[model samples]
Target: MSPARAATSVVDVVAAALRERILDGDLPPGERLVEGALAADHDVARHTVRAALRVLAAERLVVVEPHRGARVAALEAGDVTALYELRTALEVEAAHLALSRHEGRLPPAVHEAAASLAARCRVGDPRWVRVSEAHTDLHAAIVRASGARRIIEAHGALAQETRLFLLRIRPHLGYARLASEHEELVADLERVGPRALRAHLRASAAVLVDQLA
Candidate 1:
């Protein structure tokens, strides 16, 4: 790779590591991200660390202010509301489209995602980051089944943002409840219908909003 491209690649790698740490709660919200410390820990130059932080800032996973450096982004009630509102709209439509496209039979990916999530739910106090990823994968499968390429692409970014927010509000969601909900969602898609799935999404969103409040 070219010199510039190599630097970009390193930044991506460092940023992903930091992102996982943030989502896994190793670095809690509002924790200051020291560039020099990160550089030493990651064995990269300070400039590379700065670049990585900038990439995270673009994703809204980190916040940077003049002279203050970067920190894990602190979420507000409004942020939660906006993210869920848009997420709900996209996911509800994806469910409907997937059903319409597949004639009520879910795609294989959807089933796999559901099974993975169900298993994770059975684990006691499963990590918030893993739960968030499994949940997003389940929804992404639904969107992929819709065969709407653009919607699938859009939902990918939403899925990441959803995971970020979920990390913050995971205290409100129980492992048992998450497992049961996924189980119910899979059953509803098979037997009941899209309306049931939509209701489930809205209800889940409401719980998150309440927790944030």
Candidate 2:
């Protein structure tokens, strides 16, 4: 591989590792990501670590200050609300389009995602990361069902931030409740249309915002 390509690959690996740590709550919000420490930990050059941090910052997973370096990004109450607002708009429209374009039937992947969510929750001791992954998968399936490329791309852009928010509120939203709510939403998407999705998103946003208070 060319030098530049090898360097870019290393940056992606480091960034993905750091991103997982942040989302899994191993690196809590406001925790400083020291470049030197990270470089040593990942056995990469300090410049490589800097490049990885920049990539994560672009994804809104890290906050890079002028001299203070990088820290895991935190979602304030307002940020939670803003994210859910945008999520609701995209997801609800996607639901509507799915119903209209597919003859009022959601694609099979939506059902599959819902089932995976329930299965994750059904584990003896559910891991928050697994539950959050399943939850995000279900929502992504819904958006993909819309068959709109731009809508799918827009929702995909929110995936990392959404997972961060989910990690914050996972304790409040118990696994059972999360599974049941999504199962119902999937059912309602076929029978009742996009309103069910809007209500679900709004209710989830309210819970997150309330917890941040």
Candidate 3:
């Protein structure tokens, strides 16, 4: 590849790396993103770091100010509420669609995701990031089962934010509680159907929203 292409690839790689860290809670909300520090840490140029930050800013994962530079997006309580409301709506629909298309049986991927989540929660004080990823993966599995590419695309960013929110709420929810919830969720999806799934999602959202308040 040419030099320009190589540079673009590097910027993309750096941006993806930073985005994962932000989503994983390694870089928590409101934490400053120093370009110089990141460039040095990643062994890239300052301008490359700036490009990566811009990418994150566009995704709403980082907020860039005129004078203060970039920081992880500090979602307010209202922001969290709005996100969860949208999430519930889309996920509820996805669950309904999945069940309708698949004869009321969730794809095996959803069950696998549920099992992974349970295993993560069984670990003593599992890292919140791992638990959060597992949670997102389970939901993603359900959405993907809906057989709608656009819905899955729309859910990608929302899932990342949901994972972040889950990390923030993990201390209050506890690992055992989360594990039990997933076990129930899988059972409900396979046996109880979409109504139960919607109720479960709404209740989970309410619990997280309450923590934000």
- Each model's Cα RMSD: 2.0, 1.2, 2.1
After superposition on all CA atoms, how large is the RMSD of candidate 3?
Answer: 2.1
Error of 3 at 208 (Å): 3.7
Off by over 4 Å in 2: none
TM-score of 2: 0.95
Top of the candidates by TM-score: 2
**Which parts of model 3 have CA positions greater than 4 angstroms off?**
none
Q: Count the backbone clashes (under 3 Å) in each candidate.
A: 0, 0, 0
Q: For every model shown, what is its TM-score relative to the native structure?
A: 0.90, 0.95, 0.88
lDDT of 1 by residue, 144-181 (tens): 88888887888787765677777765777677777777
Q: List the residue pairs that clash in candidate 2.
A: none
User: Model 3: clashing residue pairs?
Assistant: none
